[model samples]
Target chain A: DAGITQSPRHKVTETGTPVTLRCHQTENHRYMYWYRQDPGHGLRLIHYSYGVKDTDKGEVSDGYSVSRSKTEDFLLTLESATSSQTSVYFCAISDSYGTRGYNEQFFGPGTRLTVL
Target chain B: SQQGEEDPQALSIQEGENATMNCSYKTSINNLQWYRQNSGRGLVHLILIRSNEREKHSGRLRVTLDTSKKSSSLLITASRAADTASYFCAQPGTGTGNQFYFGTGTSLTVIP
Candidate 1:
């Protein structure tokens, strides 16, 4: 929450347009994640990166793509923005330990995207 | 699909009272975590209890995990108005996957 930040806190775009949301963390955590939140539904993971150039798709990765070219940055891109893609996006980072998957994730303030 | 579902979607209590919220998950998990989120804000990790551990506490926050039942509960003592927020429980689902599945969450209102 304190170390992670998402850029363009609010964005309004038209359908079929491309949009990119950026997640930056100063903590240098090893694991970065992208999620979307909607009404009646909690946060859902879209994509996650364990390290630079190592990314994987989450349960809901249909219209989203993620790239982590650097340690401090993870980007989520909407190839063709649609109204269904309009939701709040969150970036999270987790400090890795010897025991994998045991670390807690820290979240960003979130980016609110509107597709018109 | 959401791995957890929280009970009493919303709660209202007066100051200095105790508040409790329950979360039920679908599958076995290594651990369960509770988080709090204020309006228009990010989630703050509250507490995490492993499957082997039944209960844990952090100041006024107490968390209990019942692995046999695949459920967990978060308790807040001496609640204040500032505690009014949404609380969610998340657990890494049954898989090698790293993603943590979250519940719908419970909205807590501490009326002063």
Candidate 2:
């Protein structure tokens, strides 16, 4: 596996509450991504970080935020949880993208979050 | 918005039969990749086919890309029960740097 681990593998939080999920990697990869998987929606990117303190929004950035203060850690926070935010969140790491060869992303186990 | 859409949302086949899934996408792409996800697990990278390449194989998995049609297909030969999972195709969005857009996915059930 890709030496990636997600904390709080399963969680249930009430609506309007704050929640944060953590992704820690040991591969020292330059790219880290957060995605949410829902039925009929596949996996939608929530946020991603290219380097320390360098982050960008993805296709489904609403109601979510991310931060990467170190190369090994990436965090996803739901400012105020909602029923629609309930889904399986996955964290991925990649060495490079759009480069000459090598664009495969290694994924972590995943985190299942439920909003009541 | 999702860039890729997979056909036959669900599939069922015998253990020894072959399994094929098709993905159609909008917009240009540099490459297309396939992934598998078991129940309650993260996605596992299966294979990738570049836009310039027509076909590529890895073990029993073969991927074909047709840029003219903007589509791709994945074939798994002699499928086994272990191959039962949801398969998805992904590609980077146009003008988006390092971001991947995934399809809704096809759920496969290989009967033993």
Candidate 3:
């Protein structure tokens, strides 16, 4: 939990609703990522941000969106929640900017979202 | 298809024994990293081994990378009950290389 925090530790929402999860970090790392963990699927990257306002889709980016307006905060949003989206979400930050090599990533506790 | 996958989907061992997990990837990688997650918690970074380096050690953990085989292994010595957790291996994604693809993970249960 290297200075990383995810708001709304747990939430239960019905399908078709919009939900947002926030990830705040004190380290101001250059990289931020959103991931979802489900049994048998391990962790799948939902989205990632390299710098403020710069974001990219991941392996499971469909049906989800992300925003990074500031250096220390990254947000993941589900426009229309689906029961299939129910899973534990995690936020991670890394100091390394380049791909050649990366410092270890620090993760937040996580937010568990359940959609019915 | 470039995602890293861990072998031995589940492991059960007694305390004080050594536990080993292996990871195999489909493509080239600059490095490989191991992370552990306690039940209901976020992942915690364990160790990282660069492709150029054959092996690396940190505390009770030893990580070995085999670039030729596109695989990596994590060995934990003197396993403890506290070591019961899920272990995942991650590597840079194929396209941009900025994002990482993590494996499903190996569930380790260390019996005391």
Question: Taking the candidates one at a time, how many backbone clashes does each contain?
Answer: 0, 0, 0
State the lDDT of candidate 3 residue by residue for B1-112, as single tens digits.
Answer: 4567888999999999999999998778888889999998899988888878999999999999999999899999999999999999998765442677888899999999
TM-score of chain A of 1: 0.95
Q: Predictions ranked by TM-score, top down? A: 2, 3, 1
TM-score of chain A of each: 0.95, 0.95, 0.95
| Chain B TM-scores across candidates | 0.94, 0.95, 0.95
Tell me the tens digit of each residue's lDDT in model 2 across A7-108.
Answer: 999999999999999999999988899999888888888898888999999989999999999999999999999999999999998886545664878899
Q: lDDT for every model? A: 0.89, 0.90, 0.90
Off by over 4 Å in 1: A99-101, B93-97
- C-alpha displacement of B52 in model 3, angstroms? 1.1
How many clashing pairs in candidate 2? 0
Worst 10 residues of 1 chain A by lDDT: A95-104
Rank by lDDT, highest first: 3, 2, 1
- Alpha carbon lDDT at A100, candidate 1: 55
